[model samples]
Target chain A: MSPLHLCLALSAALFCTGLVAVLIRGNAILVLLGVELMLNAANLNFLAFWRFGPGGGEAGLVFVLFSIAVAAAEAAVGMALVIAVHRHLRSIRIADANRLKG
Target chain B: MTTLLAVLALICLAPAVAAVLVRNLIHSALLFVLAWLGLAAFYLALGAEFVAFAQALVYVGGVSMVALFAVLLTRPGRTDLLPPPSAARAVGGLAAVSLVASMLASSLFWSRLPSMEPTAPIPLRRLGELLAGPYLVAVLLVGLILTVALIGGLLLAAPRRPAEGADA
Candidate 1:
């Protein structure tokens, strides 16, 4: 009933949704969104544990801040790679990248 | 009161599912933004101010923009149509649903859980100090990893101009 439990449940659900998106979606962008969802879900877990765990207040907050910095850098590099690959391949559909089947 | 919190959890999840399931790419992207905002609010309600800011600034602002830009770059004339659903997708959905159900059941039925209230939370400065103290080795390793990743990304994304000997 507590907000902490609520955060956990939502994070779990989002992670599952992301799992489905990653497995089912053919588009690379959709897959990237799924990845973002999973990352956010993990972030929520950290924050919730912070709020309710034995390390409340600022320790969790500090860790979450570091996580955000990491996520931002990851996003930048990931999108750049996506752009570069798109330029080389002219398509974003994961299915279209059939050369990898070998 | 517990029921209300559970219901709100469902509300938070429903849009995330929709964001994943929608066939339209643009709709999926927009729904993803909403999902981030929802999670950010949830983080705030849970008394995680730093997490809320990170969700707002990093995922909402940085990741989402990058995703949208990637979408714009790779989409071709296929923008007018929906991608056909595949047979394998059903199994993936089933797996995801089963994972969610199992996690929910465990959380609901688990007889014992640790709930500790913090008495002395180290401040952000202390966290940094700790990271630099006993955790210094791990921090240094992560820094090295990130540095390599950045260099790799730069090597990959460096732009190339058009050839000079093209059809002049």
Candidate 2:
């Protein structure tokens, strides 16, 4: 397989691992980490296509940069939410965070 | 070259798998940093030097610190072992993930991907121009969003004051 194919396959596998982590893990932080993994997988796909596809320009690179910034923002907000939830519930387990208001 | 890619893939994936499976929250967070570093290496291999550095700085540097801090701040006890998920939940999640993975792999293989030659990496200077020129609006928007998010995060994570003399 070409390097492009290899990159795509790796991205798919990473995405799948992330999905499983999100679905199975009880910890809110791990679930957030899983989301980060999925986002990174998507960024890898973008970089792969940009490297191999026609009309190679700066668009893909720019998009990935924006994506990285957004992902960082998401991580900040999500972690804050996790901390808030933990303060309220005294546990970071997703199952324990059943109530909407405390 | 293919063998190198295979090695890189192993480096990227193993820590991710271990992170998910490991019971300790701190270990899981650190393992994620390893996975991010592997991904940055992949970016370097792909000839996106700027992106690779940004990935290293932003992800491995910034986000991993955030994750580690969150993990530390929210740990319930001395030993941060997460309880094992229910067997049914684990099996079901694995089955669903595998189904999606198979579908993605089959589609990827069956599609006629263009066999294009790898292009020269864009100069960092040109990339900067594009960001300031055509993508200026997007850059501004991202900045705005990031500022808002940071402020929101601070507000959300701040300690609440106890109600004082409310009934008096």
Candidate 3:
């Protein structure tokens, strides 16, 4: 298999695992971790493409940097939301959060 | 070259899958951090220096820490902290498998993409120029948005009226 090919497969696997965790899990923290895993998987894909795809090194590198900064910001916001949820509900379980609509 | 990359790629994926499957939330989060590190290694293998470092700095240093703190804030009594999947979670597992398989197949076959040219050096400086030249506006806007969000979070987390109208 091509080296880039292997990286792509790995990224895909990471993303899929993350997706599974996000979808089936009832814990908010686990869900957040799942999301982070998904984001990293995509970033890996970007880096791989940059390395072996068309973006080449520099442009891909810079773009990935931008993505990382954005991910950081997203993490901050996400954590804030988690704190809010924990405070309001006193439970980190997602199944219990159904009070809003259910 | 292919073998080296393949090995590195496997290394990246192992912990990533473990991150999702582990029982303890804290341990899983730690594994997630390691997974990101592996991805950074993959980036380096691809010759994308900036991407690799950015992954470490932003993902490892920034995002992962935030995730840890957020998770730390949540330590509900052991009454209810559900772990991994049961047989009922089979549907999700199936979907995940299908998704990974499809993506790999499409990228490998349908794209027919030519491997990057090995002779030409990566245009690192050009990216820098573009960042300052054309992408600065977007970057500044994003920063402004983040500032606003941070302020909003602080406001939300501020002390509020207690239930039963107790003034404290």
True-contact fraction in model 1 equals 0.57
Q: Give lDDT tens digits, candidate 2, residues A1-102.
A: 888899899999899989988999978999999999999999999998899878655688789999999999999999999999999999988989987778
List the candidates' TM-scores in order: 0.78, 0.95, 0.84
On the 0 to 100 scale, the lDDT of residue B72 in model 1 is 72
Report the C-alpha lDDT of model 2 over B55-138, residue by residue, as the tens digit. 989988889999889988987787788889989988998899989999999998998888778888998899999999999999
Which is superior by TM-score, 2 or 3?
A: 2
Clashing pairs in 2: none
- What are the runs in model 3 whose C-alpha is more than 4 Å off? A54-59, B78-93, B96-100, B103-111, B119-125, B159-168
* Quality class of the docking in candidate 1, CAPRI style: medium
Q: Pick the candidate with the highest lDDT.
A: 2
DockQ score of each predicted structure, in the order shown: 0.51, 0.82, 0.56
Off by over 4 Å in 2: B162-168
Instruction: List, residue by residue over A1-102, the lDDT tens digit for candidate 1.
Output: 555566676777788788778778777777777887888788777776776765534445656666666766676677777777777777777776667532
Off by over 4 Å in 1: A55-59, A100-102, B1-11, B78-81, B96-100, B115-151, B159-168
| Model 1: DockQ vs. true structure | 0.51
Error of 3 at B167 (Å): 16
lDDT against the true structure, each candidate: 0.70, 0.90, 0.72
Candidate 2 docking quality: incorrect, acceptable, medium or high: high
- The docking quality of candidate 3, as DockQ, is 0.56
